[model samples]
Target: MSSPVAMIPYTNMAPYRQLGAPRDCRFVPVVPRVSIGALLSGEVVAAAVPVGGLKALEGVVETVGRFGIAAEGECMSVLFFSCVPFEEMHFPRTIRVTGESASSVRLLYLLLGSIHGFNRLPHIAADGRVFDGELLIGDRALVKGQATAGEERHFITDLSQKWFDIHRLPFVFARWVVRKDAPGPIKSAISDWLDEFKAREASLVEQAVPEAARTLNLPPAAIRRYFQVIRRSLGERDVLGQQLFIRQFEERGRSLLFQPAP
Candidate 1:
């Protein structure tokens, strides 16, 4: 049988495999924003796609919300700026990014600009050369300070923390979405598999990274945090949180889903 495809950036997805899940479950790690566009366009099928993507594809009927990744107070992971003293930021400047991320980067901007009250700074995609501040999410954000005690300057704005502060609940980042046209058995199987996988994440993380020392890099640690944030952001089968998130989609005023699958 062909393996199921899991698209997300978090590295803590291994537990799903360990828990008698499909070995064929191929994980396609991607940034939240753009990936959702592609998924809604039918470029891809199932993914832990961003909330933005979920908004685009709403009413497709096959998709559903799940889980939350909570970061109470301040998440040490998912740092926003690459430099210091966030209150005093350079404005009207173009910041360079690696050109791989989409959602978190923009989401960071909204959180800082719209909510946190920072001046709008345009993001310029550059091949190389670090800017004064850069938003680093997933594994990189978790272990960013490891190299030589801060060679790179970063102001840690925990996205999840800010989200909870505003929403009074966990922020929903992504969801497990099945295609509307997908077979019923396939959807049911995936649903069952996800439930089992969710239960096993805690035990897996314990064995996977028993010591916090191993997490100072953007590898496994970031992956762990990604899972952590996602789990916390979702609550009560994500019914209430999803309704709130839907408004965010409306605010963007973009078509969340493609007419036909990409």
Candidate 2:
């Protein structure tokens, strides 16, 4: 008998889960966007991956314009930025990153350089940076936040909100993708799973770490509201969201020759 697979939830994966059970499959806890490069490089069959991973796939994708994880106005959860006052954030300071996130590192850099006009910051692994102010994402955001908040001595920015403020649209940090030659059935299954995941998010929320509530300093009710916000934002087919994503990325490409902000 095959082993029972555990379906691990991702930050942006709720939409997939809402689509429902696969006919003969058990989903597992594959993290977000980490698999994009591998899948496109033919290292894996399929994955929900970032566009950067797509570019890293060694000339596999000729054009990356058709698909991505964009939304119209305020995704709320993704794309975070933190900093001290311009006076305090020692210029040429080494920025530490939460080690777990593969996607946000690139996402953070693009938003900063493109949207906020910040240039020339070096990336250092989490352990190497001794400073209290550093960008973090995923489980670490919940796990280590309270201990570091305010005490870190910096002004925090949510890149999603900032993007929304600037352009009045949602940011698409990544996308669900497969190799161009991948089997059609696999793509269909993945799409179906995403639909079910979005529809049944309430069920998933119950299984979430309660510590997240305390860590975010939100009550359970507020946590539920937060998830609701994510659902509402992602599910909408708002033009504003897509426009924001395309405009920023295209503008950057024109100026910096960037591939995509995955």
Q: What are the lDDT scores of the predictions, listed in order?
A: 0.52, 0.48
Give the poorly placed runs of model 2, Cα more than 4 Å off: 1-21, 41-43, 56-83, 86-90, 99-103, 114-129, 143-154, 198-219, 232-262
Alpha-carbon RMSD, candidate 2: 6.1
Root-mean-square deviation (CA) per prediction: 6.2, 6.1
Best by TM-score: 1
lDDT of 2 by residue, 1-262 (tens): 2212223254444434554445444555655544554555465445545544444654453322234454444444453434564223333444565444444555556555653354434334244345524665554453344344465544665555666666665565555544566566655655565555556656775544254466566566645544554532243443455444555454553333222111
Cα lDDT for residue 76, candidate 2: 43
- Compute the lDDT of residue 2 as modeled in candidate 1: 48
